[model samples]
Target: MDLHARLKTYLQNNPEAVGKVVDYNAGTDRLFPLDLTAANTELTTAIIADTQAFSNWVSDKLRANNCRYGIGGYMEHRTIYAVSSHFDTEDEPRRLHLGIDIWSDAGTPVYAPLAGKVHSFQDNNNQGDYGPAIILQHDLNGLALYSLYGHLSRQSLDGLSVGMSVHKNQQIATLGNNQENGQWPPHLHFQLMFDMEGNYGDYPGVCKYSEKEKYRKNIPDPGLLLGF
Candidate 1:
């Protein structure tokens, strides 16, 4: 079977093995679907460029919907990356987001959905970068899998080390503020990868539109494990 097929089958077979990536309660909290694409006319360029304004916009959306979390952006073609040159390239700009972003308040806790060992971690502190990020290595039977948590608080990396074992539902990190989380609104960039391609600490969360098919093979929708 292919990677996507295997992942979907594994998740479907072992629902109890996966845990929440955030402090979400199905009974009390609602998840508001957020749109950061060009279709979202309300997100003006000015608000996209201004960190505080963008944060306030996210908060307003969640509050208006009476939800605790704003979630979306898996394989989403986002225009918000125009706010930073970090995503620009001579060939093409990276506009396709390869992860699911959980928009929430800074300092909100992030948890591991499965037991794994820290594969790599570092603070990618560039503008529009991932900020404090982590990649965990997991095994589904014999299949090698990886999970990345990005836009995390610097404190999240405080005692972490390579190959450190983490348990399911363990509090691994917290969401960071705009001042630290790549100058954007606070959110957790959760992604799953079949391979790291020798990358350590950080990987491209956004890919060039032209290379979407190439990345699609390596990166799959995180919702497979998130159970959204």
Candidate 2:
């Protein structure tokens, strides 16, 4: 199925996350939009430049202006689901994206949207992968589920263990910079998964467009909660 169809099915099955939520056009109104500027070489160069200077200047600039930096691209930017480099292989195949990303400055605090237990934690520690990451297992309506928070600082996972309890709105992780993070501009890769497939410490946040059906079954749109 296509992204639209898959997303609709997931929401219909998982109403508690999507039901009666505040409305926010999250993909729109972001500080930056990931477009051809991001797809082209010139902008890639500029991004490298910005990444180089990000720690010393960018963070302060966003905070000083009191701007709530966004985590994903704007709706006008035409963000599409493609297999990320993290899982691409000529010997094998590619995997596509399962979640929407919001591009924001680093060091921003990531909050737990609801109370849950720390299901697992890991330092994925590879280029184009989640750096320091954590997943929380939530019991909603007697249904077991999980939320994955990616691109976090190493400090975020310190003292955190599998099965640890986390409170709602609790500060779990501080967003990391590019050096410690997965070498992209700072952003959170938040994903919701119904079945972990017995996986621990890592899960495919991206899947192949061709295999969208299989992945969409396991991963659901995070906006069902955050879009509120």
Candidate 3:
């Protein structure tokens, strides 16, 4: 079977394997979708270029909405990525977000949605990078899947080794501060991938806009697991 077929089977056979990814364990809070895409003129003017101001803007928005978290940007074309050379190119830029981000304050603990072993972990210390990232490999009735937790605190990577066991709902890492999480507002850049594409410690949570169709196939809607 192909990647999509396998994904469908995985979701069908193991509907309850995954659990909460962030502080919202119920997965049914007052979650709002944020627009960091090029279309938001207010955002363009509000954030400016200050990282603290950007973080403040996110926190203020969540507070104003009475929401604990703001979600969205899966396969979204965002302009905020311009802060880093990693996402830039002389030609077409890589503004297409391939992951679902859960925006919350720094030091917020991140949990494992399912029992799995660490596939890899690394501190990708670069501008607009994952900073500290961990990928966990899991098998549900013989279907192999991987979950990526990105933008973690620097201490999260300490003492972690490949193949370390992590159980469901286990506190694996905390949301990194700006300095550790690649100079962006704090959030978990969570992604589910059928294949690693031979990458380690990191995967393309954001991709080139032209390749959106290709990435969407292997990367299923994370809501299937998050449930909200």
Q: Where does candidate 3 stray beyond 4 Å?
A: 25-28, 45-48
Candidate 2 lDDT, 133-224, residue by residue in tens: 88889876555668888888888888997888877667888788787777656777788787789888778776545677777667766766
Q: Which parts of model 2 are misplaced by more than 4 Å?
A: 1-33, 36-67, 73-85, 91-95
Per-residue lDDT of model 3, residues 12-114, tens digit only? 7777776778767455578868888878887864474677898888899999998888898788888888777898888888889998999998999999988
Q: TM-score for each prediction? A: 0.98, 0.71, 0.93
Better by TM-score, candidate 2 or 1: 1
Candidates ranked, most accurate by lDDT first: 1, 3, 2
87-189 per-residue lDDT for model 1 (tens digits)? 9999899999999999999999999999999999999999999999999999988889999999999999999999999999999999999999888799999
lDDT (C-alpha, whole model) for all candidates:
0.93, 0.64, 0.86
Highest TM-score model number: 1
Clashing residue pairs in candidate 3, if any? none
